[model samples]
Target: MADSIAELIFIPAPGVGHIISTIEIAKLLVTRDHQLSITVLVINPPPTFGSGSAITTYIQSLANTTMDRISFIELPQDKTRQDSKAPMAAFTDFINSHCKHVRKIVADKMSQPDSGRVAGFVVDMFCTGMIDVANEFNVPTFVFFTSNAAFLGFKLYIQTLSDNKNQDVVELSNSDSTISVPSFVKPVPTKVFPTICQSQEGLEFVLGSARKLREAKAIIVNTFLELETHAIDSLSKESTIPMVYPVGPILNLEAGAGKASSDDDIIAWLDTQPPSSVVFLCFGSMGSFDEDQVKEIANGLERSGHRFLWSLRRPPSDQTSRAPSDYEDPETVLPEGFLERTAGIGKVTGWVPQVAVLAHVAVGGFVSHCGWNSLLESLWFGVPSAAWPIYAEQQINAFEMVVELGLAVEIKLDYKKDFFNPKADKVTAEEIESGVRRLMEDNKVRTEVKEMREKSRAAVLEGGSSYASVGRLILDVKRNIL
Candidate 1:
């Protein structure tokens, strides 16, 4: 008998982090025995430049055999006279408006001779409009949440807030102290909620899309139940959709499969270092700080007197958010004469194969932006971290790592935001010095984090709940949904 074919459609939000998660899902499906096919549909900002657009190039570079199973579809870009200045809302509107285009693409693909039999749809959680397309095709669609189930449950609570009743989120977040969300599965700090949701319009947008998200056939969160059982259970009970699969630490598994790094020179440098002596610092694709904060971080690392590896990036010319204007030189982000001073102890690079660097023996601690991907990567390698969340749901993710899970400590920066012009003030040298010392000098804290690392590793292994759950998701999709 001929093998049954399964067609999976992917529609990721236009961001490097989102694309990375969507691609990982597609790749995982392929690794299973299913005869899988993927269609990546893009709707906003043209997906033509930056790390967001670079995903296409990376996909093309995948093995030619893999290329045969995946397809790309592009829609007409909307250049309407809209307020593109506000990125989050503008981007959300673009995705919602692309529903018609998305539906059209799915229809055309289904009609093609080589399209094979449609089975199930795997849509990014953010692309809630694609649910209608799946319904039209009479197939089950699962929402692949790119973050932890805790975040999703928190989002669900925020979605239920009526615009008329709750004009802004300030009431919810007035206290920096932890606020108990009435229906949420876990206790979350109001500060971790998205700042944009503080406004009425932003609240409406989030609530509207969230309702659409709840319409999926099933939900797949990229985190293990062992890591978030209570949150996952709460979400499953509340949602009408029954299936909630917690299959994660996915990056760790992928990284493990990667060949050992061939950077002999770098490895040699690390080998000479003492145990638990180096701090590894990396921000995700979108994480960037102003020049002042960058200098504070550099100075802090320098004063800590520890071996370090810091990955840095230069801001683009047209950038407004998260880009620093003062640092014109490529190396200006670093402290003055600091590179020479820490020559024997510090390594600065624009970017490195992050997973590989984290896996190195010499690396002991991580100072990170708390992006879910980076968080998982750090935990997988048994490295404790200093959490520094910059944007999006990072603060929320950081909360889980530090306060809830007891995996990492939060690094606070002192800055002021003017109502007229909101740019972060530079981080002071003292703030940097104290934060680094807390991580490197505290033995009791490091030991506790080491225990958490062991738990994280066990959560992803065979017979572990996460591994078993992923197997069930694949099998269920193939047998029932497909």
Candidate 2:
């Protein structure tokens, strides 16, 4: 088995971010060990979510890349109707339904003489249900945790909450009381707990999934040790926890570095700006704002008197609509003459090459939704953030950035988007102006990020923490030594 090629099958949740990040890890393992081969099993989301165009495109880009050890296969859509469950539960149930297909694929891989030794399975945290399929094969499993270590510890800590303790969490969310997690340095406001896990069933689902992590041989987290020293330390100290490997920030740096894409017009504009002069405002792919909210942002940016690049998309008609479309005429949404007023100083575009933009010399600060991926990307480029988090676990991420990490200026840590009424808890222009100014003026944060950028780059090198962790992971998978 050691003489034959070792194959690693990666099962990522159907989200684009999850898929791409998982591929980055596969690319790393293959590059480090010439004996490794990777097969990424792609499962498209159920039909209710609009077009799967982005997901398809991202995978195609990988297939077209120069890497030969990595391969991608799209699984047949499950199409199993799980509407009887809650939204989050339904989505997870959808992932669970694909286990039979996963089992078949692994069986087929093992049967082929030239397919190499089945190293083990690498499943996304949300797809822990697939652990059963791995146990059936008597094979080891690893989880590619896409979030930060603090969030991971928070989940594990909450798993201790059962019966009366669980109800107290519900009450904490309903009220404004704060709670303590061993992972975080200070008390965490209950409002910032993951919005999905607020309900009793949601908490059970999150805890239930995270609890399965212990069954794995190890977990490959997309973070570096220096960034989350306390949380990572706590996780490592636990003897019962799965072997935790911090082998990141695993980004496709070459693809993002100095490479011009179809979004060259945006890049060309950045070329004209002075070094570290522009503030970038981008919500994630699902990010959009109401006209009133848009005007507020416009009012804020115009008042800040700073060069800026904003990626603004049209708000979806309702929450069920998965994709947000770009407006044909952005002027219709912005305040009249706002563009003309900031003509030389600002550019508003639909979609952006996020990493390429952050890599630009002229870009100074990021106004972001604080998605874990976005946070790591901005940090890699040595750019500070004015956090404007929306939905998901972004609120928790924002809190960590501002209060714990000191790498960001907070705009609104708890601004979740309202699909029905967009004006609900709208952040005012005053807040945006102050946050942008603070993001740029904070010498302390900027210096810390610049230092972190050097440390981040080093973490993946031969002797660095991330490099060591990856080596440990490879040995464990190759030898089943854990």
Indicate which candidate wins on lDDT: 2
Off by over 4 Å in 1: 1-3, 42-85, 163-170, 174-177, 182-187, 239-242, 252-268, 320-331, 413-422, 443-461, 479-482
Among these predictions, the greatest TM-score belongs to 2
1-482: candidate 1 lDDT, tens digit per residue: 14767777777765556666777767766765556667767544433233333344444433233345676666566666345545546666667678878778778877898666667677777777778778888888888889888778767777655443553464664446555653344567666676555555556567876787778777888887766767777776774544788888667344323323534555677788887788988877645566677788888888788789876765544533333222235376677798789889987765456777778888888888788888888877777888777666677787777777777776752122222125655656776667667767767667776666676667657778777887887777766433
Question: lDDT scores for all predictions?
Answer: 0.68, 0.83
Evaluate residue 315 in candidate 1 and report its C-alpha lDDT on the 0 to 100 scale.
52
Q: Which ten residues in a row are the worst by lDDT in model 2?
A: 253-262
Query: How well does candidate 2 score on lDDT at residue 130?
Result: 88
